[model samples]
Target chain A: MDWNCTLTEERLSDYLEGSLLPGEAAAFSAHASGCVQCTQLVAQVKMLVSRMQQAPPVEEPRHLAGRILDATLGPREREHSGSGMFAWLPSIWQPRFAMGLVTVAASILIIFHASATAGGKTALNPVNMFRAANRQVHLAYAHGAKFVNGLRVVYEIQSRLTSQPETMSEPISEPARAPNAEPRPGQPAQPPASEQRQKSQSIPHSGRRHTHGASELAALSIISREDLTNGAIRSIL
Target chain B: MRRHTRRVYNLCYRFTGNAASSEDLSQEVFLRIYRTLPSYRPEQGAFPTWLTSVTRNLLVDHYRRTRRDRLTDSIEDAMPQLEEKHSPARTPDRLAQASELSAQLQRGLARLSPELREAVILRDLQGLDYAEVQKVLQVPEGTVKSRINRGRIELARVLEEMGLRPA
Candidate 1:
């Protein structure tokens, strides 16, 4: 078959793509090899086609998909301002918030339980609740004060007992008397000379110290009783 | 949906050479697709081919609708917007070169007739084979080949005139 510049130009893509018959391709190549304009045209078109094929697709706008979705699917529910009002509601379901709410509810229940049981019988009236809460608070404060006084008395008695051992190391010319022995009925009411000497030596302020020790022991007993009652109430609850 | 959107958007941008118009056209194409989805038959073609056809038809309509504006307005005014809009986060030297070449190619494509431009875009730029291009264009395979050939030649001459040698 005869080939010319027109045939070469018309079938240029087919020739470049190697889709033309072998004879036709040879003829097209021969014609293009001799023709300067055909060669340049072939080269130019070939390069342009290759460049275009290799060119990356243009980057679309970042929000193009979102816009298309919005247009096709209608506006999203989250985009509405009305729905945004309740957005914070989801946050309330978080573990941290749930735990906090549970703790507060438990504390309120405990307070109500304590107030209701302050008296022998349960009273749900506002005035009774107030009076019960007030009484409970005073009782708690008194129990705390008594416990502290008991600790101080125990520490003072321990120190005095420890000092007594050291004093007992000294030799005694008279026999030792019981510290709490009462005077015999027929005997004189005055204390023995040995007791007087020991009192004078051991206790510089005997009267005041003895009175304070007695009051502290009484407070300690009261605290022990309160603790037992509290334990029983807890076990019942 | 995202994949289809990008394909449609790239087609519109390459055809119109205007970012805003391309964006609007892309949305319009998908909107039409969404409405006519149920009517789409599987026997017609693959989903992408159908999508391309839909996009091409909308683009042709858009072209006719805005013929008067295109005649009166300069394409150069729309060319710089593409460059300004594309500020990639990390542009290596090669990417910058490709970006410049793409812009130049866009200018060249703008000078071609709509038929030739779309033929070249679908076949060469969009990487569709001749058969797919024929399906998208709804034309004979011979006509697709002819148009692609002429379009490439014309574009090459235009790019040469603009002092760009395709490397």
Candidate 2:
């Protein structure tokens, strides 16, 4: 009666349905004949299966078939249409088309604007270019000369003090001696106090932006100083 | 129009237990079958077996989504049609007993845990081989065997309460 090691439900179901292998079928039949518990279990299982078998088939809904069919077939129809190439064109070229249009419009506007500004000028580099550049260089050198002249005055004052130390302590008490201490020949005379202040205002501040003319003049002044140093060295040689 | 729909509809009805939901679910299953027909490999299994697998899958998904207690058929509002090609001929007494037994079997089947019920349904009711049942249930053959064993024992216990033996 104890059928602990009996055939399983899957095997028994197979047995009932006549789908079991010959060996399994033979073993099951022999076992069922001898074991009361397994026999009874098989009978109950058979009845359960019979009831299920008797139950009518379930009907699927009608529209679901249509819905699924439509889903699968819709793509096929689009693929078969004559405008397939046309449909795909937008997808392929949309981004490139947008970029090309923007580039062409920008290029057209640049060319038109450049021509409008050019007006009737023969070329960008006329004789005027060289003249304007040379003028700027000249102006820078003139300003540099003024600076050197002021430094000469300061140096003269220092040398005069060393040559005559009495002038340093007697500037206020011996103001009469100042008139005789005029600048020597070929040395520029010091400007009046108000005139000197005006000249000082003309000097460029280091941090301020300079005009193109000022920059060219400053470059010329540097070249002139280098030339002077080379002349001095050659004379010594 | 009505008869054909009704027959297939009845199959869905019994399988799902709720006539209304079965109608909807069955429609969905057939639609799936219709769409997936091109992909079905005959070498894998028969069409009916494949259809049943699809139906079972759909029912399982619905059961999980609803989280309804499947072990109790307390909401049984309708019975599946009893007449079928496989229904064995019987005397009135046996027929009454069979009907009662059939209802009890349904209740017992409803009571089974989904795992055991799936194994039993796939192996017994669907008539799938062990290997085929393994594929359908997506479990090892041994696991399929154990679930079927447990499910059968539970069903036998249910039957014993009604004074029925294997007969």
DockQ of each: 0.45, 0.16
Q: RMSD for all candidates, in order, please.
A: 14.2, 22.7
Task: Report the CAPRI category for model 2.
Answer: incorrect
- Tell me what fraction of the real C-alpha contacts between chains A and B each candidate also makes: 0.77, 0.35
Score each candidate by Cα lDDT: 0.78, 0.58
Residue lDDT tens for model 1, B53-95: 9999999999999998766766444554454456343234424
Could you tell me which residue pairs clash in candidate 1? none
Report how far residue A234 has shifted in candidate 2, in Å.
99
Instruction: After superposing candidate 1 on the true structure, give the runs of residues whose Cα lies further than 4 Å from its correct spot.
Output: A78-237, B74-98
Which candidate wins on TM-score? 1
Clashes of each: 0, 16
Model 2 scores a C-alpha lDDT of 0.58
Off by over 4 Å in 2: A1-39, A46-237, B1-15, B35-45, B68-102, B162-167
